[model samples]
Target: MAQQLILVTGAARCGKSEWAESLAIASDRAVTYIATATVDPADPEWQARIDRHQQRRPATWQTMATVEDLAQQIEGAEPTQCLLIDSLGTWVANLLDRSDVEWEKIAQALLAVLPTSRGTIIMVAEETGWGVVPAYPSGRLFRDRLGMLTRQIGSISSTVYLVTGGHVLNLSQLGQKLDR
Candidate 1:
């Protein structure tokens, strides 16, 4: 059987990334940290956040930093490679300017590769729907798209963890699946 697909999602600063990292560290496969964040040295706060994440990772692991090649990177992973993708929201935001048709194509391609993909895949996602509705069209678009993507991924994931308030809840085991 293929390894379980794990998803760790939560609000900002809720330790979701750390939880996902722990999962990767526990895996026997070679861990590869797949960063979806863009490197913007001009933004000190963003750079600091990235630096913190970088400092947290072990030197033995390989890091693939890319804003656009996430699906391709996942497709290229070795069967024994454990990929810890430290976010889905950043990746979505990076491509927010794409047309709806274009975005759908990209999303479909990613969904296609995920189902039968090899190795241990642990994804870190942000929960975006719990707050007030976005006030702008672009913001709404982002929230809807991300919400859809996470729900779809969560549907297929073998384990779904919701980390909030310093608590990690295994939604996959504790909650009922929503039938579409």
Candidate 2:
């Protein structure tokens, strides 16, 4: 059987994560929430944000922190399980210090693993390119890399959802996929 791939993307605070969680709940399979953002105990705001997401998840769903690596975590999942990876932007930002060449390798590895994973995958990604071009070189790199990664993921995804203003649009149904 082919594994399901779902991509949910939106601006920050646009309920992207919540929407992805809903899809996971609807899957009727054992769900695992993979938090890509590393928990920083010292940062109160970040801690609170993580707490809110944790509180929102159903207790029946297991949660995994991607301290090892997101690709590895997904690759290890059971075929019958559902994996919700909330926010790819953070994952990109976390490794922003890497050179462009290194980032490409990382992104390629992730793309390679997504389709081969045993479980259903739902990814929440922030649409950062819709705003102004970033001033800093690093910021620009982050936006560009994330945009490219999201596009690649969307290409392989069976379903792509755009969440904004509490509305969810099924891009896979409503829009045309651009060939790279």
Candidate 3:
């Protein structure tokens, strides 16, 4: 089968990660779990959350911690390895932190990464635009930019999934039933 890009999106605390993990495990190709989450030493809650995620993933899965240059990492991936990008929301947050970055630039970077990927790629991202607007301009900007990014990614993805309340619903016609 040709390389496929699947975009999985959902609200925070939803089972996006679990679903993505399931997809990766089911695929016969070698799996590469690209984690974008950086450890925050001062935040115990975040650290705990990361630990919980680590406990859930299989030990056999190769993990790569790529905080920056996500596009570079994705672009450099071997054609034989299936890649799981757990959460684009964190990547967007990191991009927002840089004053020189632009939304279109980020979107283009992501688009460039997917076409060259040889194996299946499943991306997980938070669905944050459905909720109340944030008071801060930057927060709102992030939400808006994320919405745009998701739409763009979904356009190129062969399959798109939206998880809510632990239920995963396929949004694309090429969808195969996912065993949750």
Candidate 4:
């Protein structure tokens, strides 16, 4: 099968993870789930989210918790593995909180992995630009950063899907929607 890089984008609670997982399964390749979520014991909600995700994923899929150094991890993984990076928003947030790396630097690092890595890539990113402006500086920064990352990845992705109400719409068909 031809190697494919897919980008799945949607708002929080919009089934981005589920859709990404489904695509990984359909790829018929050795799947590697790159989970960016960190388990925060202090926050019950986070713990619950982690548990739900764990329960939803198949036991046969290999899970890697690379909350940091995602680019390096992806680059180092076996070329034949089908890589699914769930939620670019969380990954960016983790990096921003951990280091002084600029957004472009991070994007470059992520973009570089697909060329040399021997695997199909399925990236998940939250679509946050449609909502009202965030009240806080960090929130605003996150929205902007995620927007940039989404566009960057989407440009290179062979397929891009936007999930809403558990249904997926091919983003490449947006402009052609009226023609159909």
Query: Total clashing residue pairs per candidate?
Result: 0, 0, 0, 1
Each prediction's RMSD over C-alphas, in Å, is 1.2, 1.5, 4.4, 3.5
Lowest summed lDDT window (length 10), candidate 1: 1-10
Worst 10 residues of 3 by lDDT: 171-180
Q: Clashing residue pairs, candidate 2?
A: none
Candidate with maximal TM-score: 1
At residue 7, candidate 3 shows an lDDT of 92
| Residue ranges of candidate 2 with Cα displaced over 4 Å | none
Candidate 1 structure, TM-score to reference: 0.97
lDDT of each: 0.90, 0.90, 0.83, 0.81
Instruction: Compare candidates 1 and 2 on TM-score and give the better one.
Output: 1
Off by over 4 Å in 4: 98-101, 173-180
Candidate numbers sorted by TM-score from highest down: 1, 2, 3, 4
Residue 68 of model 4 has an lDDT of 59
Of candidates 3 and 1, the better by TM-score? 1
Q: Rate residue 8 of model 3 by lDDT.
A: 92
lDDT of 2 by residue, 1-180 (tens): 246999999989988998999899889899998888988888999999998999999999998877427888888989899999987998998889988788888888899999998899999999988878999999899999899999999999999999999899999999999987
lDDT of 3 at 65: 84
For candidate 2, the 10 contiguous residues with the lowest summed lDDT are 65-74
**Tens-digit lDDT string for candidate 3 (9-89):** 999988999999998888877888999999999999999999998999888889898776778878877767889998798
For residues 71-167, what per-residue lDDT tens digits would candidate 1 score against the true structure? 7988887788899998999999999999999999999888887877787799999999798999999999999999999998998889999999999
Better of 2 and 3 by lDDT: 2
